[model samples]
Target: MSILATEIWENRFFNGQWAVAEKNYAVTEVATGDQLGVMGYAQPSDVEYSAQQAKVAQEKWWALSYQERAQIFENAIQVAIDHKADIIEWLIKESGSIVMKASFETDLAIQALKNAMILPSSVQGSVLPTQNGKLSLAKRLPLGVVGVISPFNFPLYLAIRAVAPALALGNAVVLKPDERTAVCSGFVIARIFELAGLPKGLLHVLPGGAEVGEALVNDPNIASIQFTGSTEVGRIIGAGAGRTLKKVSLELGGKNSLLILDDADIELASQNIAWGVFLHSGQICMTSGKILIHQSIFEKVKQRVVEKVQQLKMGNPMDPSVNIGPLINQRQCQRVEGLVQSAITAGAKLEVGGKANGVFFEPTVLSQVTQDNPIFEQEIFGPVAVLMPFATDEEAIALANMGDYGLSAGIITSNVSHGMQVAQSLKVGLLHINDQTVNDEILNPFGGFGASGNGTRIGGPANVDEFTQWQWMTIQAQAPNYPF
Candidate 1:
């Protein structure tokens, strides 16, 4: 049976096997608001049951040899490759992703899966120097069952970033994807793993609302939590998980900046700015919320950006020519609309586009934006670009740093050395020189600082730290002797 079929609701993966839910939630296409299908709604008791099953299954999964575990991810990668077309289709329909964005996201998901194949062997332990007749060592072990709660934007890549690594590192996972993107974020993953020959009970997918998320966080059987969403919700999850002393990794929101210095190639800088502010309709957490340009070339850069923004066609994601698609939903569209209007009302000039037809908000660019403007520091997670001018490099850095979010930032300049120095001054976690902020590689430590995240880095070696706990062990040929 095809996982994307409407009948999938009756076979949603839960605990060890496919099970039907007593209740269901309708999933809809973001672009059209048409019903795609329904998914099982997990109650608190269902979350508890899933966690218990994951706990039991984790031990069995851990017993597999590293090679054995790696093979499963290899198979899963192949499975994903085979289903690439279906994956892209669902991403377009289910997540309002244009062809270009959906293709990029699908490729990233496959790359993330390929990266996980190495994690089982990449983790290393350390030997500590010990006194005579004693040997000591430290080893990393999986954190029993990991609870993953992912959001709607970049649903596939964000969810896989945590899920693949956690499972490859020997921990079971109970995933709670946002109800809005259940098919692409949760069911597609579940289907891929199932076809890859992953042992039953190791992975459970539960798509539901806030109550289910709260249940996952508060469940005792869940040893750690990996979450990717807004800062507001991240704070709530962090606080709730802290009470149980459970480890939590929160990849939250961002109000990133793209700094265009005087020496930067205008063509290159303008291109990067357009991509940073408008890619995925600027819905990415790493999206450039502010475009800071040097006073000498601010107008030139702004004009170029506006030209690019104006050329972008917004419509149904299924159309290959469409560069931008609808915002995730009406609620999100209204939130973006409010922010753009508030900025304009606060003396910011609307440069090119500032209109909305339902969920299809025009790609907007604003200039003469002051710090007091609500959009200046807030994450306008839409295709709206706020422009600011600065006289000196120090002033540019200061302007970029004037936000509570320290997630991602980019600096475009011919002077590489100067760009490096300026980048270092910004408090953001990820930095790009001569590139846009919306960049990610499986090897990079993909996370943010401060309100963006709680100092939890994902990807590459960071996964070992996020998904496992360290244990210190001592050994002797016989019993240890103590002065008693």
Candidate 2:
């Protein structure tokens, strides 16, 4: 039986139990507008209570042996695998993800859990040398409680990236998944951990609106905040967390680029561009926002990309044949439509798609897009690709660096050394050579620069730094004789 069919699907997980809240939010299927069920809607007071309980739970959790804590994650990996079908269904229905994308997200979440299994053993303290006759050491300790705010796009993967590490490092987590994807993003995770025998009160799942998020950021009991969403919301969270001097990590928006150099394979470059721009309807943060092609083969690359875009299928994601799915909601559809219309009005040629039917938007391709066009400057989180021409490598680099966001960029060329030189000049935090912009690995450091993030990296070794604090300790055989 699916977990959603049981009582576990109806309530929030907090205070070590699944409890119904005073308010509830309807969970609807984004593709079909069908109501799946309702989830507990957290108020500010609920957030406050969760934070208080999380702090209490963290103390006991941190005292456990590393092996004991690691067992829970090992169990979680199996539990997640056992329920993979239900998880993928929830993602496809609740988050508007295609079947392939949902499966990929589920795999990523499981991979994150697998990676976290090593964290308990990987955390090591260093012995330091001191001038005085004393034993000195630097140790990493958990940050009591971590507050996570995940977005609707890649909810499962984004939430697990932080939640798994924070818990593996002996910290309690209070997660606020976007209300729209509460089932797959928040409730499903709680269910997995609960089945895996995680100690009570160590993880809290709260789904709500801005009020809940603000309370999570402001709660005194929360030691740190991890957020992944739009740059606009990230700025607010950063400011609010700053007032209280809390550690915060923001993986915000991205206006990523894909550069097709003069020496590139046109077919391979075009294939990557289509995949990067249209995957998950381009809802990914690292989705290619700009496509810079060398002027010598600009038209050839554009023709290939347009042909690929026109072939993509957009509709309900439950069907395996559908490559593109609906936007998360009506607001997002309108927002994308508005951007496309505005760009078209601004003299950007809409080569293929500029139409929308209900929530499903066609794969769009635009040429002659100049910097002055809104589509060129903005991070359009839609299946829209804007193509621009560049004269030289320097011009291509300048075009890639034009936006405020410096998240991720990709370069494709037969000349590997030339691609490396261009990659170095780009301002993005993550760069790929001979690959597309939207890429991730469990062991790689995932983050961005400038408006894309606040200089915090997540994944692999970076998790040890993000989820723990460093403390220096000194000890001596006897109290050193000091002048009284």
| Estimated TM-score for each candidate | 0.98, 0.98
lDDT of each candidate versus the true structure: 0.90, 0.92
Which residue runs of candidate 2 sit more than 4 Å off their true CA positions?
A: 11-13
Please state the error at residue 23 of candidate 2 in Å. Answer: 0.6
lDDT by residue for model 2 over 124-229, one digit each (tens)? 6799999677999999999999999999999999999999999999899999999999889988889889899999999999889999999999999999999999
Residue range 328-441, candidate 1, lDDT tens digits: 888888888888899989999988888878888899999999988888888888999989999999998888888789999999999999899898899999999989899888
Per-residue lDDT of 280 in model 2: 95
Question: Which segments of model 1 are wrong by more than 4 Å?
Answer: 1-3, 10-13
